[model samples]
Target: MEHTRFARFGMVCTVDHLASTAGLSMLDQGGSAADAAIAANAVLAVTAPHACGLGGDLFALVHEGGGAPQALNASGRSGSGADPGRLRAEGHDRMPFQRDIRSVPVPGCADGWMALHARYGRLPLAELFAPAIRYADEGFPASPLLAPAAAVLPGVDAALAPGDLIRRPGVARTLETLAADGRDGFYLGEFGKGLLALGRDGAAGGSGEGEYTEADLERVNADWVEPLRARAFGHDVWTIPPNSQGYLLLLALAIADRLDLPRDPSDPLWAHLLAEAARAAGHDRPDVLFEGASVDGVLASAAERRATIDPSRRARLRDLTSSGDTTYLCAVDSEGMGVSLIQSNAAGFGSMLFEPATGINLHNRGIGFSLVPGHPAEYGPGRRPPHTLAPALVTRPDGSLRAVLGTMGGDSQPQILLQVVARLLASGESPGQAIGAPRWRVGPGLTGFDAWSEPDEASLDVEQGAGWTEGLQERGHPVRGLPYGGAFGYAHLIDVRPDGVLAGAADPRALISSAAGR
Candidate 1:
């Protein structure tokens, strides 16, 4: 692939091959950490177009040198036509959410990167996306990941084109303009017209969707939000601003802190521990959250009171679709910078309404909008959906990056991320060992486990690539094991040693990469 033409590194790590090469090239050019991140994100919009794209949402937590970590939210907003009252009259209240055309929000992924660039980027936006721009204009081989998506849609290949030189020319051109002009160029220009035009013809029924006019896109702006944080073990754990499931990570970490990571996440007993934690933590989504809630500020303030233990129950309930199997990435650069980015289309394919114009798939976030009247996150004029895309970052004492990390798989994300953090910091594992380690996912309820190891319920441990499928089976949780590097929500990690050298690890299960420097 043209995007993979080369690789260089002062310090960088990424989830896609082309993305890594793009970022590494920036680092080699002496670009700052933010520049490399912007570069990597552009490539992801290209190659990993399945789960993420330029027309999507993005969340990042950045820590530059000795500075406190700052967050960036590039999530899209709703249109004026949306109305919460209309949705509730139709009766649709559940999570693990559903997929509908109404879920598509104005994409903020590109703008979000642009926002990050403006504050910390050293190179021009055009330079940051040069590789991706060339690939989109010139072309590159279709990645294996895109094959199924291609086949699923009739005429998607021809509509979007296929073969070695596959490219999203439309989105590429849109990105080119955004790179030159910043966030406004995309949301306010021809790009906005195209997005609105496409979304209007979509198949979902919700407000802010079905009929957004050019007036709406031209007038709408991406809002900047103060991300939420919760103190854990004396360290500050920062995550996405309100309207996202970030609290789940804080809840999971707190729950895990109660249990124990000193043992394996694959143990039968460990499975129960994780399941209980997930069940306990996941229940908060449907009942507690609403549109007006100040999820961020209040979460920490209410941490003492709101942080309730199901004193009687052993676990909590989790919604599957609203927070399901997903994808995530994390990285830190040579400048002592850290980034945690998580993007998704809601479901495996989102609205599954592939835009023939840009190869950009829309999000099913509207599925998360409540059908209940007076609900906070209901489909309405300018309301954000309850999101599962929360990426977490932790800073160690003395002002250095401790862990730059995140995971895929909805509710399972916080579950996996918390355990890995503990494994790396508490268990004394190296970054590689910590991330490459075997993983497990807690379930939606307090019933049986969704364990990937022994199902015997008595056996309590399994190793990586171990006959974990068998272990999970014997342990009573139907487990689907893959060839070692399975979809365990691989977390791209960079462990910042005291001297500042980074020991990096990209989940081998997924196509991830990393490089470090002094």
Candidate 2:
């Protein structure tokens, strides 16, 4: 609750209190939003290593005043040695999700940091990294959020008590190298060598994940591409193009837009509409993709699907758990530049491939690749997997930035954003109100599929509050209630108020999620 103490400042929001402070510190130093974002994320890598790290990939939407939003795809590609045929030959029917060499990819977070800094950073890399370095070296107390991951991860020694000091000297040294040498420090220099060795160590029976050569790491660069744009709620929403599931947000919103949403934030009808829209949008996942994908087609199809859903029809709900351990942060500088950045290590502790010398955990983002023969997302050398890190930026037609927003929920990212944006635009809710509202997720259940049935047959999990259980069942949705404040995915938001002031909110459902500004 201490972290939830919200006050108005030049807006910044992040999942960790310390990282939020770090971003505001950058803003106070006259840094641009890009600088603050990288700085905050660096701190997050240390404080919330369970979710993200220096060994992950990053995606961002950066808006420099008076220009279109910039989309940065820093996601890493599969190793040049990656071969789906080999895995298939090894007797695997699908991509493996375990901690193995096969899960590792050339990490892109370091390259992403360099790219943002080269384009928009004001402070030196050393100065920007000071806070993170200090935290990793001198140590900081762990928050409640670290418990679950620490309990399961191999080497993390999470602080037993809330105020206990936790030190990450290896991470500290790694940050120092990065600050001194930039991206090369991680990909081609000392850090890179160590990472390569760790990959070699993770090699399986005959398949070697360590096949990534120095060239693969050095060639990794964050591409600055045009953002995928869609017209929603009278504002333009921008997200990273292709190799990401961002279009799902626009598609779901477009579907919900066709409905008459209840005025009350707690109305169960909002949940039903959002759930159906999310399921419908996810149905056409391949069509709205970034590789030459179209917004018009996605919107038209979503609208058609929306018209077919009957609120009163009950669909089966199943329980399913999606993969991903990710983090999202938002920043708006005094200069009016804004950024929405999301980064991740795939599953928890990512691949569990640790560089014994540096303590860096390699990401398992390759797990996102499909093993199905001929699938667009099928595993291949030099191919980036379908990423779920969807950072969102809302801009008026005039190009004025409206909101910098995102979350850490893997497949749930777009669905959560759909509901949050709807509340912000349709009902005129504040960022905190919209983010804190009860949420629901519809996905494949742990049990087998429910009879190729209606969308409601998907497992539905809603937070316990606002009479969701009784209300949803009455509408014929097979549903279950999760504990209040459980991991329904945490959303961070910074939206521009009508009067030009910036408002920030951290999801109350999460412990230690916070916002701060000058």
Q: Who wins the lDDT comparison?
A: 2
Error of 2 at 192 (Å): 1.4
Query: What lDDT does the true structure give each of the candidates?
Result: 0.60, 0.76
Off by over 4 Å in 2: 1-9, 151-159, 204-206, 286-296, 314-323, 444-457
Maximum-TM-score candidate: 2
Candidate 1: regions farther than 4 A off: 1-9, 84-100, 152-163, 202-210, 219-224, 260-271, 290-292, 295-327, 444-487, 512-518
Looking at model 2, residue 383 earns an lDDT score of 83
Q: State the lDDT of candidate 1 residue by residue for 1-518, as single tens digits.
A: 01111112345556666777788788778787778878877876776666676656777777777646787766767666665555555665532243454556666676678678778788888899899888877766665556545554323444333344565687688778887777678777766666676656644554434546666666433445666666665566777756777776776556656654435544445454554454455545664454345654334433333233333233222222222334466556666677777776656656565555555666666555666655566666666676667787787766666767776655456667776776665567676777777765543222111221121222222334643455345535445443444345657776666766666666666643444342
Q: What TM-score quantifies how close candidate 1 is to the native fold?
A: 0.81
